[model samples]
Target: MSKGGDGKLADAAYRTVLEKILSHELPGGSVIQERKLAEAMGVSRTPMRDALGRLEGEGLLVRLTDRLLSVRVITLQDYLHSLDVRMMIEPQAAGLAVRSLTPNDISMLRSELAALEADESPQLEGRHWRFDDLLHELLAEKSGNPFLSKLIREMRRYTKIFERQTVPPRRKPGLDDHGRILDALATGRAEKARDAMAEHIRNVRKRILDGL
Candidate 1:
């Protein structure tokens, strides 16, 4: 009940660890020890344990044995598995989003995509990812289903390993894909929106798998 109590400290630990996981700073399959992590992070064991529990609950980490923890090592098969789930769910979310999304939301999404296109850094990887994430999150939220939105968020989270390690070089189609999805959503036709999203996701799945 108190701020920064066990739960709050645990949450702090969770965010710190999750950020590392998302950034791939802690690469997949890297072993994690609670006592060591707590010591490194200047946190107590309780919060550290709680944080590990939450990560495992999210399927971002795995318990290998009584005393072993490791970041989830996602294989190409794992990528396909997650992609299958996304293909099934995200297109439907996009379809439903057409009904729930406001004009303002669409405008914001357009702005984000435009920003992404304008970015010309020598290393445009992170910029590309941020914009893609924003677009997906917006679409998921607009679906008006919290469960659907959370699934999208988690799928994105777990797949960061692949995205960061192997950014498909020919990503121009991705930009166009996002634009197409947005265009379809703007038409306010659920079927069109769904079809567009399915195309985009399938394109991405191929892009990712083809590289491997």
Candidate 2:
């Protein structure tokens, strides 16, 4: 195959493996066998290896030995620390993003959340995660400062890995918090947006702590 074809395969492999990790299908500390994974995924070793390397570079995978790799195990402490960092940064990101985000963007996300709330299916967990991603990613991307945006995105990615380890995410509370955030942003007040975002993160931390 051409170099372009190889790159496409590698990209595909990367996304598939990353999704598995994020979805907890391959939970923390799960061993990754390159050859077996490649075979199971019906992809070439080269692409699978490349994908694993990328995930490792991103700190999602750790090299256990020269011949072994495993998913990074995020502890409860690590999750709390990540949340603390997010609490510091994401509110500021939301405040900054309020002016940049369009009405349509807010409306689209609101619609998605409403749909998820209305649906009573078992598949709601995945949709909740997707909506969460959409809301945070939009805020990060639109945050005026690129450095802040990058930090928020990275912190969120870490928190997400930790969040899915617990089955059936806190859906109702989370959706309600998101609604408050959207309402604050819609009012075009930076302070309100910041407060709403901070409260949302605090609520998340509280819910997790309460569960323990």
Worst 10 residues of 1 by lDDT: 164-173
lDDT of each: 0.84, 0.88
For candidate 1, the per-residue lDDT at 192 reads 97
Model 2 lDDT per residue over 133-191, tens place: 89998898899788888788777777888878863465455888999999998998999
TM-score of every model?
0.89, 0.93
Clashes of each: 0, 0
Candidate 2 backbone overlaps, count: 0
* lDDT digits (tens) for residues 152-200 of candidate 1: 8988776667676555444344889989988998899999999999998
Candidate whose lDDT is highest = 2
